[model samples]
Target: MRDENEMEELESVVERMQQGDRAAYEVLLDRFQPSVFRLAHRVTGSREDAWDVVQEVFLCVHRRREELREASRFRPWLYRMAYCQAVDVVRLRSGKRVDAWGDGEEAHAAAPEAGPSARAETNALADEMNRALSALPEKFREPLVLATHGKLSYEEIAGTVGCPVGTVRSRISAARQLLKERLSAWLGND
Candidate 1:
């Protein structure tokens, strides 16, 4: 219900987009860039990689605007594209086809960058949280980020991930459990 306003705004942009309004797409980009980059950042675990992932995401979305059926779910749809784009970037870098069930660590999902900071304790905790997230399997990481940070619903996540709604719920539940166990201090209320 709340997202209606967001959808309405995006719909206007998408309509203009459909009418070949390049400017409208730019507006859309401005609106969603923060969330898109965050999703990319989580997936790639690097600011630079995330930036590249976002550019790819927008390009892919722009190319596929004709295929969008649910503007109300624009945010999730955008996220799915960002997710796939991140995966693609990682695969291209590694020069291998991504097997979803790949061994462990997935390496590229390594911790996001953090340098010497004025607040060492906070920096250390942030680094630890990222490491905990990095240790998670990709299946869990994507669902958790998309659901918790992306603020996507189970149904919307199901659509984005091309999975059943129940599966989305189960995956998010499993991810939450893992985070609770591994990042108890950072997460709090374990």
Candidate 2:
């Protein structure tokens, strides 16, 4: 679970982003791009425009964030925005809306061409993590990334989730427990 301080940081970042602060937007982008890009890539199945969808998400947020009054809900609200943008891009491109969480076989079909050993290690890790992360429900996965990978605190996660702090803690706890049960064998008990 997350601590309580991240909300302050997120609030400040959101304030800066709302003020047309390019630096602040850059910070937000840097912080959240992995999860955002992963989500976009999973949805679109196009490595090329997965980046495009990420850009569009922020652009749309920049354009419409002013409409939101509550500062705390910025996190989840932004994700919802990104989700809509990614889906729209996919629909427009493929002439069909993909309802799956990721592209299935096509999702990771664009593996980088590289030496066999290097690719093997990277792909092995990717395969395990992707499978574990994707196994969790969207509710769990979203908060898990926000707390661990994004390093957001419980209060901040609550804001993003529009839920109580307790709920954030419980969900993150459950997510970690599940991942540990599934991954601890490979990682060892250390």
Candidate 3:
């Protein structure tokens, strides 16, 4: 369920956006930029590519603002757009299928603030997690990222990925199991 305040705000933005208000579009961009970047980064596995995706997504949103009927559905709709754009970027760069996998270097580079030993451990774990997530097929990776990183409901994920709810559920479950198996080995549990 959407919060009343957020819903109201979104409605206002949508209304203004539909009126060709650039400021309103800017507001929407500001609100969604970080999430858009994160989703793009996760999908494309390149910060530069992610930035390009963000710009293209907002441009597409602005161009198609009138197609949006309900402000409440904007989150999932926007995610769908972002996902598509990121996939396109990946395809264009690779000239092949979309390979949704990170190199693990980016994950290791952005260490959280902590003591040296703790930070080192955290970096190692993060790199391992990135590698595990990268190994997942796009079908599994998309839903897992939407559910966990995007904080979307199963239904929302289904809508974003154009899959059934049960499929989304299964993919996420399978992805989690794969990650657990991979990480367990890294953690010396296997």
Candidate 4:
């Protein structure tokens, strides 16, 4: 969570961007691009699609900079745009064959010393987890991803998803329950 000072700084940056400050826009991009990509990836379940979404999102931000009336609300507004853009990509590419999980490059990087068997097991588990997540209904999946990967608060997610905070809470809880049920075998609960 950002402190009060950080939020104020972001608000100032957003205001500057709205006022045509290119430097402020660059700062926003540098700070937010990675998170936007991760959020897009989790939503669309395709790295390529995520990249596409990120491009579209920043473009939208640049074009629609003046649409943001309250600078303090920039984060959720930006997330909403990214989320909607990712949903569009998913809808457009629904039938295309793409990797449902990202390449396990990050996982491999984290455990470079692991033996071959360990890596294989890790990859298998990650594949299963990804499959389970993909199986979730979009309503549940979106909020869960926003919370876990995007690291948005319930209120922030509510604003991004245009839902009540209580609904966001319920959806995230339901998503966790569903994932647990789907992965019960791997969890040794079967």
Candidate 5:
């Protein structure tokens, strides 16, 4: 999931955290909060809920830090907690599934220099993409979001979602195909 240097940094941080270093825990929080929020937001489709999930994840990590046997396993362990917490929040909150991908702020912010027409086009495309993502089944959507937004590998996704690596690959592939089918018009495939 992370590059070698990043993984090394994570391992060092995790080792310090295992030793009850509060500063190391802070480092972990600072390093992973955004990506964790992104994964939670994509899976839960609510910024508020995602924030809740992120808080719960870090809390759990801090409480159960000793349960982690390997420093190398910290990343996926954190992500698994995030994935589970987000799903639990969705289940508790009226059983409504994740219906939107994100608020499109990131998409808009990424292209702030664009002309008005270009911004409108970007917004339109973002809307279409969100719709396509929302239409996917949860089984497919979860793995895809974990891979794309969480930046996790298939093995990591499999571990987080509690499935085999092959199943994760299939779900991600199927999700992409579904998205392609849904956005064919925007993609100029018509």
Candidate 6:
């Protein structure tokens, strides 16, 4: 979710959008495109599919704009929509029940100022982390990603994930514990 000031601004934009203001919708798209894309990519594990999710989500939102009752809650509502769409894409591709979670570290890797050896090490660590994250069960992975990468508050994560706050907290804690165990050797704690 956005900061307090941004949230207030977003509420205003959402109000205008609900009233069928195209420019307001454009502002919303610009502000949230990166977040939506990142969530989609984290869930779908493919940039192409993430783009598809973004388009599909916004289209759905636009079509159902009037269904939105509270503009202040738009962030979680958007995330919920994106999550559902990404899950649908994964299900279609795999023909199985699994939540998407993978490969977000590439975007946050160290800058090019790092030496070649350092860069290689960073890349290797990132790869290992991605693998560990992807291996987590859906219940744990979803909450972890929403909290850490999505920067959602516990309450917001609960709303988006359709779980109670306690459940969200437990899942995030368990996800971290599992990741630590999986990466113990690489982290030199074994």
RMSD of each: 7.1, 7.1, 4.0, 2.3, 3.4, 3.8
- CA lDDT of 117 in candidate 4? 96
Q: How well does candidate 2 score on lDDT at residue 126?
A: 51
Over 4 Å off, model 3: 95-128
Judge candidate 4 at residue 178 and give its lDDT: 99
lDDT of 4 at 8: 90
Local accuracy of candidate 6 as per-residue lDDT tens digits, 1-190: 5677887888999999999999999998998889999888877777888899999999988998998899988988888888779878977887432323445344335365677777777767766777788789989988888777577899999988889999999999999999999999888988
For model 3, residues 132-166, the per-residue Cα lDDT tens digits are: 77688989988998877577889889987888999
TM-score of 1: 0.71
Q: Show model 2 residue runs off by greater than 4 Å.
A: 1-49, 71-76, 83-122
TM-score of each candidate structure, all chains considered together = 0.71, 0.57, 0.77, 0.88, 0.78, 0.81
**Pairwise lDDT winner, candidates 1 and 6:** 6
Q: What's the best-to-worst order under lDDT?
A: 4, 5, 6, 3, 1, 2
Q: How well does candidate 1 score on lDDT at residue 17? A: 77
lDDT of each: 0.72, 0.70, 0.81, 0.87, 0.86, 0.82
Which candidate number would show the highest TM-score if scored against the true structure? 4
lDDT (Cα, 0-100) at 55 in candidate 4: 93
Worst 10 residues of 6 by lDDT: 95-104
lDDT of 2 by residue, 13-76 (tens): 8888888898888888888777777766765656666789888887877788687787667776
Clashes of each: 0, 0, 0, 0, 0, 0
Clashing pairs in 6: none
Q: Highest lDDT, which number?
A: 4
Predict model 4's lDDT versus the native.
0.87
Q: Which stretches of candidate 1 lie over 4 Å from their true place?
A: 91-124, 184-190
Model 3 clash pairs are none
Report the lDDT tens digits of candidate 1 across residue range 17-37: 767799998998898899887
